[model samples]
Target: MHGYAHDKDNYAKRLRRIEGQVRGLARMIEEDKYCIDVLTQVSATTKALQAVALGLLDEHLKHCVSEALAEGGEQAEDKIREASDAIARLVKS
Candidate 1:
């Protein structure tokens, strides 16, 4: 029913990889890895997450928002507003 549903498996796989990256980050901290190395990995992990977010946003725009806009009414307006709020949150993050 959702925009990302079609590719849900891919999304889940990516999230699982990100989860492993996070666990690795914790391990690095426990091992007292070098600051710069840890920071680099952190940046990598952050970028991976951002990539997933952007992908989902793209799917939302192409599927959900487009469908609502095609219908052309209150639902369209609501979707546009909701998408805008989501974008704002992502930008702030």
Candidate 2:
């Protein structure tokens, strides 16, 4: 029922990949890999996470927020506020 339900499996797969990347990062540290190499992987992982976040936010705006706005009342306002807060959090991160 959530906005991302349609692509839940895809999201799960992406998260799993990210988890593996994190494990790789720990391994790199354990092995004393070059600092730049580890930092490069860190940047890659961060971008991947950001991509997933953007996808979920797009889905929320298209589905959940759209539906709430169509009803035209307090629910719409609440959803808009919630979405704004989410955007703000994303930006801060």
What overall lDDT goes with each candidate model?
Answer: 0.97, 0.98
- Candidate 2 Cα outliers beyond 4 Å, as residue runs: none
**Residue-wise C-alpha lDDT for candidate 2, range 20-64, written one tens digit per residue:** 999999999999999999999999999999999999999999999
User: In model 2, which range of ten residues has the least summed lDDT?
Assistant: 63-72
Model 2 — TM-score against the truth?
A: 0.97
TM-score of each: 0.97, 0.97
Error of 2 at 11 (Å): 0.5
Displacement of residue 50 (Cα, Å) in model 1 is 0.4
The best candidate by lDDT is: 2
Scored by lDDT, model 1 comes in at 0.97
Candidate 1 residue runs with Cα over 4 Å from true position: none
